[model samples]
Target: MSEPETRVASPPPAASVKVLSGVWRGLGPIVYALVAGGVLLLLMGRDPIGFYATTIESGLLSQTGLEQSIIRMAPLLLMSAGLIVAFQAGLWNIGGDGQFLIAAAVVAGLGAPLVGVLPYSLALALLCVIGFVAGAAWTIVPSVLKAWYGVNEIITTLMVGFIGIRLANLLIKGPFLSDRSLVPQTDVIPFKYLLPYLPGTRIHLGIVVALAVLAAVHYMQTRTSYGLSLRMLGASPKAAAHAGLDVKRDIVTAFGLSGGLIGLAAAVEVLGVWGYVRADWNPAFGLTLFALVFLARLNVKLVIPLVGFFAVLSIGGHEAARRAGLPNDFLLLLIGLILFFMVFTEWARTKGWTAGMRLRAAGRTSQREAALDE
Candidate 1:
């Protein structure tokens, strides 16, 4: 009787398996890209290990280096967050640099006069709102063309960005030029308006705001019906329309929201770091941000880490080139290699090569188990 006691078997841990599967899927492509980059460096007669070591030491090992890297990531994070929205809606908003400049110019032109007239908090709030609105306004024409007339948003947005840069130059060199300095920059906002930095570091409130935006966007994309509609539209406009979604409205809304975030980023850059806008001093971060969005597969959760990774590379690349006599363009080569590998991996997955292999293996295992049973 004691030997006949029965015990319940626990079910297989499907949830843990699923979690591991997700982690592997997310990281596998990145690992492949790194290996490809290393091979490229070897082919070029460079020491890949030494390059990586220097990059790590210069970008992440030192406190000052880490602070600088995080500082550089602020604007990239903001632009990527905006890009995620537009890309998810199947829209290409390539004018983020222009939007960023226009927003900064607008805030600079407006904030100077309001600083002394309004309360500090009130003026800061107004400047932020105006920056956001100006950003959205800048994209209105492109969004309309895309939504109503089905124009190529890529071209329109890109052209509009050039116009924005010229306009910013006009504002800074003409109207907003500071009285004290001969430089082509606007008057600095009052010290009271400048955002305070984090204690013991050059990092400021903008980084915190960027993190908040990232979290909020992730929540919106994952938890809301609108996010589902945007994804549907991106996947297939005709199908989304068949589902009775307002495809046109969603397109415009997505572009506006994207531009708005870029504009807020501009405002934060000026208020938090520079406190003024300089003519022809654009970071030209649009292209870099665009690359990062794709590298992260348009996932907000992934954008944060990718942006930080890029910032480190950028800072370390410059340092390494200076100290080791390496070509600065080597960093660009690495980025291009990673992009190529990522694209290839995605193509393979789409063709079902990986899944087919897994299925075949499973079939072989099943057949062997049946033979043993027989």
Candidate 2:
């Protein structure tokens, strides 16, 4: 009798293709967000149509919603992408809220002076670099403490979140205060300073910058030695150390990079939307943005659409809430559901793969046993 040929089951080509589709990965979260909508409609005792109409009119139907989406996208994408860099290196940067507040203040002040003094393109580039530097500097303190002192990074970094918020208020109310003493924010930036918007939509050049950054980060993660080291450490810190990786430098750098991008997030908002640094400009945006980072399963590339999805949810959810007579709590319920999915997806990513392989092996073993029995 011939020895049976050994075979190994592989992931289907379709699985890879499906995963490559942006909509496919996001579809699950979208469905959950929708389901939350249904719950709100039920509770509110109102028609979902009226709610959607109002929301659409507010967020998408008019120029205003579109602009708001762009504004929201700016911060969400930056926060998520920055966090992506940190998370990839097995470092948790919960301080994005802090970093963004500080960077935003600096960028708002810097953006004003740079307007038209340099060519538009050049000024934009400068803004990006400035935002990156400010954000990175914002995070350095916590990074140093965590790296050198063996402090619990999550708590130390999160505590710093308050400082950033306080500083923003100080600038708006005190230092960066609008000269005329009109609004609680700073002066409106000249239209020339604003990043050009898409012809038909409120989306702007920041999206382009974000896309470029996302591509660069993705390539670095998949191709570079540093990226490989980060991945290895993510898998096992001890193994990374044994393999001679510089864990300390990587950790600090990761936080800095993460913080820098987050800083840029604030810059985009100030330049594009508020045009001036208002202490109240972001209003808890960092909190939900951190949520979006998690919703993206810590994948940098995935952050882009996940950010959009959340924007849509906020718009749609608010609409859904009013029509359904549901309260703001309904929105929270939806957010929690989306987060739960984010977590489950992570678990599924790991366990799903493991479970699948195990099943495949079991099936192969059973087939061999049947042949022997026969």
Measured against the true structure, the TM-scores of the candidates, in listed sequence, are 0.84, 0.79
- Please write out the lDDT profile of model 2 over residues 180-220, one tens digit for every residue: 65677765568877888867776777776677777888888
lDDT, model 2? 0.71
Q: What is the lDDT of residue 186 in candidate 1?
A: 91
Q: How many clashing residue pairs appear in each of the predictions shown?
A: 0, 3
lDDT of 1 by residue, 1-374 (tens): 24322322432233444455455455566567667777877787777778777787898888878887887787778888888999998999999999999999989878888888998778887888888888888899899998899999999999999999999899888888888777788988877777668887878777988899889889888899998999898999999999999988999899999999899888888887778887898888788778778978899887888888888888887786666567777767666766776677668777867643454555555545544564
Q: List the residue pairs that clash in candidate 1.
A: none
At residue 335, give the lDDT of candidate 2.
68
Question: Can you tell me which runs of candidate 2 are displaced by over 4 Å?
Answer: 1-26, 48-71, 116-119, 199-202, 316-330, 341-374
lDDT of 2 at 289: 68
Model 1 per-residue lDDT at 152: 98
